[model samples]
Target: MGRVKHNMVKSLGKRTSSSVSPTDGSKKRSTLQMDLEVLECPICFETLTKPIFQCDDGHLACSSCCPKLSNKCPTCAFPIGHIRCRAMESVLGSISIPCPNAKFGCTDNVSYGLESTHVKECIFSRCSCPALDCDYTGSYRNVCKHYYSYISSRSTPLHHYAFLLYKASSTVRMNISDKIKIHVDYTNELLFVVQCFRESYSVCVTVSCIAPSSAKVGKFSYQLSYTVDGDTMTYESPDMKRILKVSFQTPLEKFMLIPHSSLRGDLLETKLTIKKVIQV
Candidate 1:
């Protein structure tokens, strides 16, 4: 079924002379102004693709939905899933539109039927500000302007791609929240948050990234270590979980557990290292 869909889109590409790139010297496809809701699969509310199925009464469903509905039409008790709606498939295959994030500087044109998938990984996807008091939401590219302004005075600067031995200062220890904010350089502006929680016999430390969970922008790895009485304890993470907004809820997993006895004067000290991984 997947191969059929791919081939249908491929064949439609040959039928049109649209240039995805204007500089490629190919003619652009003619624009159409049709109601897109007509192309959605009513059952799933997703854009309809090839293999659209219809009932005798004209009720339509996508291929995946036809089987789930037990080969019966939802609107009418009539049988479905056998007949192919080739006219609808051709309409879906020929339609393409600029990404929804095009307003945020995305230039790629994607098939109208696949726009939902493209939006999930769009680099220009908007992210909510992680600062508790701020309700700002903007594209990752333009958000740093609002981000750095608030955190510059209170956040610690992090040196990327290297290990930095950091000691928790007295001021941080005295803070009621026991949270530390690290701001990476502007070029790769990612906010790292380290939060400490006091348990009955241990101190739990967690690190997280503040970014949109769906944005496919940056990949990072981090290492945290603490040394007590000549013995060292370490925690390394290949990737940090991203959050859309700041929350006070305690992490349920993937936290570094440190014994309260390992503390010197009740201070939490650790060596922190972070490296950004480039994806091909």
Candidate 2:
């Protein structure tokens, strides 16, 4: 009976020791698990991707953290301006971030420092062409095509012989001929150049208002002729505001017209009116 009682006591002791060992091991494992799971930015409360340190006060934050504490800690009111830790930064930089737009069909996980650059070049990014009366917006390639289509639809058709005129100053008769070349002056207030007739006869034109605050008023005259391979060809003017004068020398047609320019308080305005004279 005594031997049985002693063995029972020893068995109970062994059981207790065995139970205590597992409990201690479980506690240690639980602590390690908590430490592994606690990796997150304190400021953002998200996974610690691109982590940055606030100070020695144990404020771990993300790199994109905003200045919310006026350069001081909100919790302890500690100055954080001079506080920096490169080791913490490197640790944060090693973290991975799930795409913010992941729900929008992005499945990329990138470093926090590379998030902005990735978003900039993302194929899913949409942009719209900035044009009046255009409603097109899409991917970069689509936007390019949309812009081209809009521009092509609104572009003015070029004519074989065309003349554009603007007013410069009063009593100054400036003529832009299809047979003359025009040059622009950058230093002058109004500088432009016109070229015609294969750059044979070019003209440099400039006009400045006599008064800085007031607009300069003037008129313009234009003459246009069409030719092909040194042979005269028939041509026509498409505007009617000017008196169209047409003359024919064999197969060649020459047209001349006078136009006007107006100014209102430093604004110069000119309009071109085209009229048809000949087709062949």
Report the Cα lDDT for candidate 2.
0.36
Q: Which digits, one per residue and each the tens of the lDDT, describe model 2 over residues 10-97? A: 3433210111236554533211112312344555454444435565585655455536645666567666545565776664454555
The regions of model 2 sitting more than 4 angstroms off are 1-51, 61-71, 85-91, 97-109, 122-124, 132-135, 151-280
Error of 1 at 178 (Å): 6.6
Model 2 residue 83 CA deviation (Å) reads: 3.7
lDDT of 1: 0.66
lDDT by residue (111-192, candidate 1, tens digit) is: 8778757765677767676566668988654455566765566555421122123222111122224454444345656666
The lDDT for every candidate, in the order shown, is 0.66, 0.36
CA RMSD for every model? 9.4, 27.5
